[model samples]
Target: MSDIIDIASKEVGYKASSGNKTKYSAWYGMNGAAWCHMFASWCANQADVSTSVVPKTASTTTGMQWFRDKGRFKTKGSYTPKRNDFVYFKSDGASHVGIVEYVSGSTLHTIEGNTSDAVKKRTYPLSYHTITGYGVVSDYITSSGDNSKGKNAKNNKGKEELNYLKKILDKNTDKKKKSKRKVKYKISKIRPGINLSVKVIVAHGTAKYKYQVQEGMKFSDERKGAPGKLTFTTFADNKRKITNGDAVAVIVNKRKFFYGFIFSFSPKTDGTLEVTAYDQLRYFKNKDTYISVNKTSTALLKKIAKDFKLKCGKLANTKYPVSRIDDNATLFDIVQNSLDETLIARGKIYTLYDDYGNLRLREPWKVNVLISGQTAESYDYKESIEDQVYNQIKLAYDNSKKGTQEVFVVKNSKSINQWGVLQYYDKVDSKKDIKLKLKSLLDIYCKSGKTLKFNNCFGDARVRAGCLVPVTIKIYDQKVSGYLLVDKVTHTFNNSQHLMDLELSGGDFDSSY
Candidate 1:
């Protein structure tokens, strides 16, 4: 074992005193505080490592920054761990600060402080998701020669490092910069072993970097029809930085806002790059002939996604089974055909959307999402009777037992008088209840098309199409409030600000032909 690892290993079984006080924290003059990073710094100091090589900070964030600033850090899958290397782990939770004791093939035997309130030895796979990256120590120039990369630095210039470390310790640790460069959007390569070691391109609109966003992300989806789309462009250092077919994800305010695959892009003469990406359903737009039997919408979506090698997330079961044949229908049309049949028969709404790259089929929310004045900056509401509104529904069925044609009708007299004779006609199964089916169709069809759109709505990272969102607006001395279906949403991230434009519907749909 290396001297750094050996020194850290001897601290095994060391536990904090009452009130979480530890020798490392005490050495750093911060008793009762977290000391994993302090423990690493202390170990490096005992081994006479230079402050320039290994930072003497008690904060993991500070340590990570120090390593990142020095160009000595490698994200997991990009580098192999060696003895004496410091590794970082897990985000959105208690992160890790561990020292590698040894590398045995694919496993990393590590010695970490404060693993269960004590110094403990642990083992994990080299490709574990919790591992963020490693901080490599450059080979140190010592009296024994240059062995710093693998050898512990001796006290050749210990006095200078001690003074440097003392200066850092004297500073106010609580002092922090208000803004730092962040990688809000991460576009990664979509292939086998994704998230393990694949290449990822990160872009940001940080004011510090001065790369302002010229084009923001736009996303839209039909409730139960076409595939959703996520498209945007940012500054690219080189044309090869982003290639068509690469996977895309937009992380807004630390949460996922959109996910898809790149399909097309164009580069400007001034180095600005414009690109377009679409969800898994983009493949569904390809026309193909397929016949389905005894399959629900969700079932057909999953089947087609699997057949096309697309990833599938949660697919909620749909309520209706449909049998149909399309000579040459776009894959999306086939899925929509099933969705139409199911909703018409069962009066249920099922949505197909990509949830952070994995395509999902789910039912839209029935409950309300209350949107206060603070939530929406401005909104435009439109109600129309000219298009896609009917007051009467007529279904013609052939009765095999009676050997005759049957006509079923359900109409709203109030709607017919107010909106004129707007009739919807379709064919139905003779075995089903004609009266119930006609009434269901009438309720769905006999309504004015109402659409509400919100512009520059405070960006909610969780908001997306196919979900229910509440909207409250007071316009023209009229108050409108309640839940509405999100038909489309576009998020604009510019100058370090995040906003979205949304088009909402009141579950308005046209009957299946």
Candidate 2:
């Protein structure tokens, strides 16, 4: 036997002995239930085989279906037995695990956990059907030459004895056809990211088997004709009936433009055959750049060009041309006015300064606002805040009948405040409430909540305690406006660099004035 099979068997033995009810539970950190996947995972880990173990919650039927979909291995009822393979039996809303020992004709000898008490070896008849598909752990097999000596010799001797018994039980083969041996081939492995060189041994018959490798072709230029023709050939053909000391190869060329190799055999028969086709193309990171296009931004740019009768060039090829009358100047104007209203609603203070470096307030005094709150210091925290507060709010607003809510600037003659407005009362109230709703929403979107922080305020925006300066909160509305204010504020900005201190209060009113 190969090292991989020995390792797999040893792992199975260890797991079977470690509490039959919870065999291999340490792998998944679940100690209460019988986990067949955990058992498989543990065995694969020992065998040094890299494979993903689906969760125990996955139905036995689903796991069986996956094996069936592979269309490999033999089945006898519900129990398909193979060396180093996992056998799952339906239990109480879950499944049980077992390891194959040896096949006695149609009867399978297996080592199983929690079967008739603890881990034990038992012989199950082939008629005890319900056999899910078999799982082949590794393609490596022991050569007939290796088994001709030492401990393997004894095992072979035992196997020969068993084969004799099997032959005695079956009395139907004709003596004339006995000279024509049966050929069997078993697939080993397919090296990924390159052309496949499949290896298989012909067990009987005339050892030569024709192999063909085909490429999935697409017409590169249909206007002219097909690009090129493809040809396949067998690399090696070892004549004479194959036993243990023989090997055959089928080489496939993997060109950069080719998709994958499609392997086939001539005169397909019920003989054992191993074929592996490698996927030449892999998931390249740069390919994602081609798949991802900022469609919304592209559409918006096109719409702007059409509406204004303006000529727009490709972003990659040219710089944004500046106009005497700035087209984007209106956007800044809208943002400024909205910021003022938002500030007032949040009960915060802000000052608007014009382009000439002059305060727009009537008092013309540099007012200072002191903000007290914790600041978020990590990238993860900031990202979580944005995902919660901004992204969630935007998504909710977009899905609502009101379309997108306008973030307005609350402004009085003396002060400006920034606040996000929600048209309907569908959860969001305070920052804490918003964070909670965002967590749930993010979980729904990402299918996992590990990326978000549950409860943590970002930070206050003031440079020093009790120190306030002339500030203006720029809100993104349809237009910009200015307001002036003087106050002491305590607020946490989830994700902002310069504008953190400002709490929204019900008493503070939002007005354009």
The alpha-carbon deviation from the true structure for residue 500 of candidate 1, after best TM-score superposition, in angstroms, is 1.7
Q: What TM-score goes with each of the models? A: 0.49, 0.25
Window of ten residues with lowest summed lDDT in model 2: 282-291
TM-score, structure 1 vs. true: 0.49
Which structure among the candidates has the greatest lDDT? 1
Go through the candidates in order and give each one's C-alpha lDDT: 0.64, 0.30
CA RMSD for every model? 31.3, 34.1
Tens-digit lDDT track of model 2 for 1-513: 222234333433333443544645654467545555555555444433322221132235655645553333345453334444556655344455565554556676665544544445666765654444455432222211111111121122122222322342231233225425442223222222233332222223444543432232111110010111112223333443323323233222321221223333332244433332222111010110011122222343343335444344332111112111111113222222223222322322322221111112111232233111222222121112222122222212222445444331211221112223311113121122233333333322321112211122222222211122322222222111121222222222111111223212111111112
> Where in model 2 is the C-alpha error above 4 Å?
1-5, 8-23, 52-59, 77-81, 90-95, 138-513
